[model samples]
Target: MSSSPIATVKRELLVRHLEAWAPAALHRARRVIYAHGYADADGGVSAEAAMRVLAEQSDLVRGRELIMVATGDDLGAIDPRLKTISAESGAGAGLAVHTISGGTDGRLPVGLKAVGAQRVPVLGFLDASGSEPPAPATVAALTAGKPSEMLLVLPPGSSASSVDAYRAGWPLFTQVELADSEEPGELLVYATTAGKSLEGFKEALWSVDEFAGVRYRDPGDPERHLIDISLTPHPGPLRRELLAHLAQAGEATVTELRTFALTETVYRAADATRVLHTLVDAGTVTRRPSHGRLGGDVVISA
Candidate 1:
């Protein structure tokens, strides 16, 4: 009757990055407004994550706020706790949740003028089930600078077939695809207007054993039908925290580490693995049963 644990797990993965990205983003601007409030049937995980982010980064987000946008008339779909936090947060000021009559049709519920009124970097996110993503204008302002970012969650479908739509929605930002048709029913596609492709995200996952069964691709890459997102991008603090988690848990299989990270921290198995080989090179960790570049048995160094 409920969504699969894997679905929740993956959604949380997105949320953790948002939490991680918040403070760093704030450094570039005086205020930050993070928006997400669509397709939140499973307890509004994204909305809750934003609230948790506000709670976690109290010092940096004093004047900054997290704006959550939800559309449609399905009151039952809305999470009551979001309202509770909103009421207690800033009386609809900071951490305000706005309910609109239409979906995230490529514009903030408050309109671009309202968003520009803040005069700060903006990060917009939408998880839509339909073929239509946020209209280009909804995300246009954020694309001008690298600091501004937009994330789109596409339901399972022909990812490559709709590459045109993704390219159109994101404007100049590189259209980085995060999934394919393999996991048909899973929350299977991610397109981000990020400075770098999620190569690090993919590589980090590849370095772990649990993700061996996972295959992420793009229609345009050398893999043709399956896009190879193999690149070594920096994972930042995610790598540090993941290593700490592994160290605390001791030498374990990749699957074991993945389960630990998923339950205990914001860093997922993939995002945290960006620094795995780096640590092995620096002796922060030692590869046992030496599997070379494949990322086999790992042991934390003393």
Candidate 2:
């Protein structure tokens, strides 16, 4: 399967945003290395040409550091060459590899052994005809800023529940939405995990919770639970109802909705209040004094 054109567009927008923000965040680095790789070739525009296109669009890559290019007819089979080019680029190099995978082509070879040594984090694009590649678990692990290690594998035809279990073990990884042709229209959760892969990691993900929800586990201390939440696309119905009730009622004491909303959802009144407060902060709702009640009225609106 491949990614939809819309998904590709969205991912491009996201990449642009990230590129704009990278410099500010990495002000201390002397230069940002931009390493480019391609999975295939197309009419006139060779992989080198594509690299130039990326370099042109990315302000960070404009004469700031070295630009390394690697291309092959098949990316999965040429993992070692990709690593070598990445290593030659320099240490602490920021990589941007573009692989042309249509999805379901088996995992594109992305090993951390070489890139990890450089301590360089990479942003990648797997271009195809459908949706963008889901965020890789390796990226999620890197975000933890911890030295721990773990390997996350998406076995062939693995269920959503299996992915969720892997996520539960690594709480530090944030979820990103991914749409790819391999699963067309199916939502996938992307999280950062350790750069290192441990043997049997894939089996462990399958052995755990059978539910289709994300979980966080710390590699250093596997006993600690970070977060465990469902990866369902739609927001919970109870959450929506509570917001609607708050909108209609203007403002009701937290106690008033405990039985119907809070208790039913297994959320404490404090949590409910926090949600409402966040809404208020975002200007989606407003808080005011209650004229006759013990608590205040929360006016929910756009």
Candidate 3:
């Protein structure tokens, strides 16, 4: 991919957008369940999102192991990109299209079935254009007791209640995120079982010159930060990177640090607080008084 500032920010947005979630959703994914209204030219937006996830995971996967399940009716007849992406020798995957019907609220998508049976980790990308968003029971049934996550794109002005219900049913995760994009007028909802990155997702797109001006939602919560960075190989340097941001900013909220990691640094929002706590632990930085062990603003030591 091109390293242009916008492209770079977008890619980081996509990755950290996901990185705040489960490990299975990215590096260790075994299957990808893609559901969309119909296959569009050039494989459609669903394919593009799935491709981004696969590309993000390419460096981690060895040999062809990941399996992709999509709708059969339209999928088999159009767009070969998914087929090509699945057939690669190393990081590519294998494709399976399940017979799926469209344009109804009650009709169940076959992709949901693929997600349920898998014992391996999964990344479910659902585009709710052809049909209404899956019911909460549906999402819960597919993700129950498994390390799984889903990214959904629904029609604009979608019912907050419906999205809420869809999120409420999932047993694995408690956070339900809603994001807006201008071009599509689409509502993007990301729900994961492990972590949160709403702040980071918003940060990746807004940029000025060399600075990708993405900010964190909350910087005071260290516990959440710990959960986010645990997925990465080295938490130490990532933490330092967060500290450096704090040093530059003088003193910032926990959410600000999370934002920095999501866009400015090659780290997740969780990484910001993890390093802040480390600095506080070492007596190198001072934190606001009485915000609990993991909560409070932080200042770089003089």
**Residue-by-residue lDDT tens digits, candidate 2, 170-266:** 4423222222222322232333333222111222322333233333321112122223332221223335556767667765555565433322332
Query: What is the lDDT of every predicted structure here?
Result: 0.49, 0.36, 0.46
- Top TM-score hit: 1
Per-residue accuracy of model 1 over 1-302 as CA lDDT, tens digit each? 12454444445555656666667766666556666635444456656666665555555655665555554324355657666766664424545555553545533545534644255555556666434545555545444434455555566654555534545535223223334345443333333444243433333333422222333433223332332323433344445555666657666665555544433332345544555666666777766656555353454342
lDDT of 2 at 70: 36
Which structure is stronger by TM-score: 2 or 3? Answer: 3
lDDT of 3 by residue, 165-220 (tens): 77664433222112222222344455545444334333432321232422221222
Judge candidate 3 against the unseen true structure and give its global Cα lDDT, from 0 to 1.
0.46
Off by over 4 Å in 3: 1-45, 52-64, 88-119, 129-131, 171-185, 196-302
Ranking by TM-score: 1, 3, 2
TM-score list, all predictions: 0.55, 0.37, 0.49
Error (Å) of candidate 2 at residue 57 is: 7.3
RMSD of 2: 13.8
Q: Considering summed lDDT, which 10 consecutive residues are worst modelled in model 2? A: 195-204
Better of 1 and 3 by TM-score: 1
